[model samples]
Target chain A: MPPRIAQIRLVSSHPQVYAPCDDSFALVDALLADRTKLLDHHPSICMEIGSGSGYVITSLALILGSESKNAHYFATDLNPHATEVTRQTLEAHGVHAELLTTNIASGLEKRLSGMVDLMVINPPYVPTPEDEVGSSGLSSAWAGGENGRSVIDKILPVADNLLSEKGWLYMLFLADNDPLQICLQMRDKGFGAKIIVQRSTEEETLHVIKFWRDPDIQIEGNEAVSGGKTAPQRGFDFLRSQISRLSFRETRQ
Target chain B: MRLLTHNMLASNIKGVTNGFPLRIEPEKIIEKPVDFNPDFLKNMFSKIDWKALADASKIMGYAELPDEVPEQTVVESDEFLRKFHHALLEVHLEEGALVCPETGRRFPVNKGIPNMLLHEDEV
Candidate 1:
């Protein structure tokens, strides 16, 4: 069998929908890289937020393969057209994901809390005027108000709540998103964060970070961060080194 | 929208505390065949809200599933698995409205995708 992924030709589109681009490709690559571990993890509930063109989620379902027949896929988008386009894309791939037209997981939060085993997101990380942050049309896909963090910040806590004890989250970030600070934020929440995949293109540099709960850091709430900056700071420094090494390897190839 | 999706959604209109298992208002109901994986059903049995699913399934016109989850022995049986699988995955509320039980807010489902977006006033 050919690798199970939605073909670009098969991927339906709408003028208002965000099409798969470099950022989307980078997100898929990150998931593909972790496919082995993901299969081993046997995630029961898999979800994607902002599934534009359905590329990343389709690729993820493909990567998981039938060994994960037990896995139920879900996706959400703020744009209704995007949701429809996502449904078409998933159907074309002979796979299905429960698609919802909502702002994040608003309607599904209480029921799905602490149940999602794997979550992926490629959120709007483009810094734009605040007014454009939630514009009605396609602009909403890429318009992230002020430092491109307006939406990313909102998504983080939701991820924390929705993730199961063994849940894993993979998210994309632009270099300007201050990935180090984001990692530190998650660390304070008792999540261990890592930069799984990093790629720099002419337009922008992208990093796909993976996060999971760290039992070691699950201390009493509100008292865990007194002097917590050092460890994750060290981790950030190490991540920087890894970034450089990976880039060097890429250039050599 | 599949009943599985229905089981997990609620009217999340701010201030409505108990908007779970949004009441099914089916304009049309369809059954799309899904590959029945007993393993998946078995895994989800414990996590699922039994009452919500039973009520929602009956509303969607599939009353095959028991009111409560059956014992482990019954759940593993082929007959129970088929009914559970049919109720959970195959049945789709092709065009419908999921009404919040408390506030009676209707979240519409069109072309199999539910519009769970809240209005500014509702939010």
Candidate 2:
């Protein structure tokens, strides 16, 4: 019998490519939790922005299974080595995705805009020197620079442009990335976001947040009048409490 | 390089806008039989650019696809779906160059892998 998700041995690797780690597992766990919604959504096209070792995307393909016959999968990475590793990984799993070695789907805009039904990203979210943001090899995989928001910031607008009317986006961010502010920014773009999975290790706290287009949220301004005022207030309070809980956990450790 | 993969590729040179459906000039092509999944083909019908796929198939020497997808509700036709599956998945380019339709830049394909890396000046 085949595994329900990607087996660790099947995930290919290269010296330069970032292998699957705690954050990657967290992202996969979030997808598993939302598998029911994803199946019902019936996405025609699914894409992953920064595929490293092809773990998350391949896992997603397996999770969807043959039920999603109509879905097309694509993945892109800045590192050429990562794409190669991803190809090997997918081949090992008997799954397939169109792999491209490009900078965050650069040439894809004209064709893919407003057509992608789902997008997933695990960006470089570790704060480092600004100059180190796009450095070579493995460093590029983790260096986010300035609160780890540089790459995440660039991805948001691109996601906004590429996502279909009913598209759903799942992304992982660190506590230092200031996820609450990121949620507000996406809110301004007519996206409703919720924290799907939260995990704190000794070194970092990872938050896997899912964003979907909300028409009511789009019409309402920063006042948060769309889902009624109470919902917005509750969201803010939840974020605040999560931040404090994460900080408290760290300090106690 | 599978045609399905080729269908999504576009040359990302510095100033090329219409770099879609990159021309496939195959030096060596191989055919390996893969299990036919009818539902997958049916799902892919609407997403594929039929004209571009027909052109690609014609170039790769498997011109079974029509200029436009048949209007006779062919999605349920096993014969049609098998042809679509063979053209999209089984045909492989072991060695080739994907020429940019707009800029004429040639990206080499070696060992079933495409090298889409660009130089700093080219980008």
Candidate 3:
């Protein structure tokens, strides 16, 4: 039987392209963990931003299999080499994605707006000097610039723009990027977010957060007030309460 | 480029709006047979811009697709599915230029890859 996810042996690589790493594997695992729901969702247009070595997108296509045949796959990267490597990876697996070497889906936005049913990203989330972000070649793959929010911040709005009403976004984040804050920002845009998977490596805490449009949340945005505060402010309150709840659970454990 | 990909692409030159159905001036269009998978085709049908697909395919010199997308009833028809499959996935533009509908900018395709990068001034 063919592997459900990309076989590491068949995954193509480049010295300049970011290869499959812990974060990449985690992103695929998150998709695998959610595979049943994903297959049921029957996404029509699926895309990956910053495809890197194409492992995550290839895994996604393989996971969905021929079950969702109508689904079209797309992937974009700023580095030209990464796009080449991604093409090789997808071809090896007998899966294919329209690969573009461009900044985040720049040329794709207008036509793709509100059309992507599923979008996944493993962005450059490491906090670095603001100047380091979007640099040439391989460095651009990891440089997040200033709490790593620079690229993440830019991507959030674009994702919002491109996502269809039923679209879902899965993205990886680091602790330093203040993922909770990122959730609040998404909340303001009428998206509800949940951490799908969380892992702590020796140097970093990584979270794969999934965002979906919540009708209740969207309706509540205009009218939701908790103790005379808006939804965003309420998100902060919810954050504090959540942290406390986690600490309480830890203590009991 | 696959029609599926072309369906999602637009000419994003700084001020170009309405960049749909970029003209495919194919120097070479390779038809590679892939395994037939009807389930995938059915699901993708809803996402496809059928008008664009038909128009683009016609320009590429193969009008295998219908003028209008048949009803979902045709999903079970293997003949219909294969043509849809061929246009969507099999036909590949090994060498071509995707001309921006609005800006007239031509993005070159080399070795089956379309270069969408823009110049600094364009950005």
Order of the predicted models by lDDT, top scorer first = 1, 2, 3
Q: What lDDT tens digits, residue by residue, belong to model 2 across residues B77-117? A: 88888888988888888788999898898988866767777
Each model's TM-score for chain A is 0.89, 0.92, 0.89
Model 2: per-residue lDDT, tens digit, A10-72? 899999999999999999999999998999988978999989889999999898878776677
| lDDT over C-alpha atoms for residue A132 of model 3 | 88
For model 1, the superposed segments whose C-alpha errors exceed 4 Å read A218-237, A240-253
Cα deviation of A21 in candidate 2 (Å)? 1.1
Global lDDT scores for all candidate models: 0.87, 0.84, 0.84
Q: Model 1: DockQ against the native?
A: 0.89
Model 3 per-residue lDDT tens digits across residues A150-229 = 99999999999999999999999887787777887788788877778877676677889889887656443376545576
lDDT of 1 by residue, B1-123 (tens): 888898888888989988887898999999889888988888888888998888888888877778866888998899998988998899999998888999887888999999998889988
lDDT of 3 at A25: 90
What's the number of clashes in each of the models?
0, 0, 4
What residue pairs are clashing in model 1?
none
Candidate 1 chain A weakest lDDT stretch, 10 residues: A218-227
* Superior by lDDT: candidate 1 or candidate 3: 1
DockQ, model 2, C-alpha based: 0.42
Report the lDDT of model 3 for residue A139.
85
Model 3 chain B lowest lDDT segment of ten: B34-43
Question: Across residues B1-123, which tens digit of lDDT does each residue of candidate 3 receive?
Answer: 777777777887887767787888899888777777787777677778899998888877779888987887775689988888888888888788999988889998766768888888888
Task: Please say which candidate is ahead in lDDT: 1 or 2.
Answer: 1
